[model samples]
Target: MSSDVAGIYARESPYLDRYVQVGIAQGRVISLSFPETPDEGAESEHDMLDRIESYLDGVEESFDDVQVALTVPTDQRQVLEAVREIPYGQDSSVAQIARVTPGLDDENDDDLRAIREALTENPAPILIPDHRIRDGPGSTPPAVVDKLRSIEGL
Candidate 1:
C-alpha cells in the first residue's frame, strides 16, 4: 500500500504451488498474471497482498472475465469488444470474432489475419480474456493460454 512500492501482490492456491499476481494502480488493475514463474515485480507487503487475496471469492474459479481499462489502439477496441463476448468455457475463431466486430475499417471475410494481429497485441490478456479465442486469433503465451483453458475447464 505504500506509494514507494513497485511490486506485484500474489495470491496462491491453497493446495497447489500455482498463484496469481495482481498489479493495480489508481484503483484499476493494470495486470493479472498466473504463471509458473514470477514476473518482473513479483514482491509485495501485507496490505497489497490482502487486496489480492480478497479477489478470490471462489477458490477454483478464474476471475479473468473481469474487465479493466487498457490503452489499446483505437481501431483494435472493436476487436477486443468482440472477443469479450465469447462465453466462458467456449471459444470463437479469429474469423468469427472479426465477423461480429463493428467499426472495423474493413470487415471483409479475408480480414482474419488482421484480426489475429489485433488480438495478439492485447496488453491485459486475462482481463480481456484473450485465451477464450480459438484457432490462434487473439493469444497469450501458449503455456498460460493452456492454463486458462484448463482453469475454465474449456
Candidate 2:
C-alpha cells in the first residue's frame, strides 16, 4: 500500500518556500522546495492551513502522519509555539545531539533551536533526491554521496 507524508513549512526567508515533497512508498524523504515568493497580503491562519493541506494532497493515499518543518523569522514566538502544537512530528535529530553533548560553552538547547530553526526559519532551499532511483556523476558532494551510500539502514 502507498503511504502519505507531508512536510509543511512557513518561511519568510527569500531563499525558501512552503512546498514540500516526499517519498510515500517506504517512509523516506525525497525532496523539499519552497515558493520563491512569500504569499503577500493579510492571510488568516485557516487560509494557511488550507494551503498546506492542498500540498499534502499530492500523495496517493491518506498519510499515516503529517510532519511540519515551519520557520519563523521574527519575534513570532507565538507562531513557533503554534507550530509545535500541530499534531505532527518535529524534526529533532539536531536537537537530540545538543541535549546529549557535554557543555563546552558553545552549545546548548538554544543552539539546537537555532539549527532546527534554520531548517524552516532561514528559508534555505533543500532538495533531497531519491537516491535509489536517481544518480548522476558529480551531482552531489562527494562526502555526502559516500556517507549516504555507506549507510547500512538506508
Worst 10 residues of 1 by lDDT: 54-63
Question: RMSD (Cα, Å) of candidate 1?
Answer: 4.6
- Tell me the spans in candidate 2 whose CA falls farther than 4 Å from its real position: 4-18, 36-97, 101-154
**Best-fitting candidate, scored by lDDT:** 1
Q: Rate the local accuracy (lDDT) of all candidates.
A: 0.62, 0.31
Q: Residue 96 error for model 1, in Å?
A: 1.4
RMSD to native, candidate 2: 17.2
Candidate 1, lDDT over the whole model: 0.62
lDDT of 1 by residue, 1-154 (tens): 6633444666664422466666766555566666666666666453544533542332343444444556677667778777766766677777677668874434464566667777887766665678888676444677667766776666
Q: Could you report the Cα RMSD, in angstroms, for every candidate shown?
A: 4.6, 17.2
Per-residue lDDT, model 1, residue 72, is 72
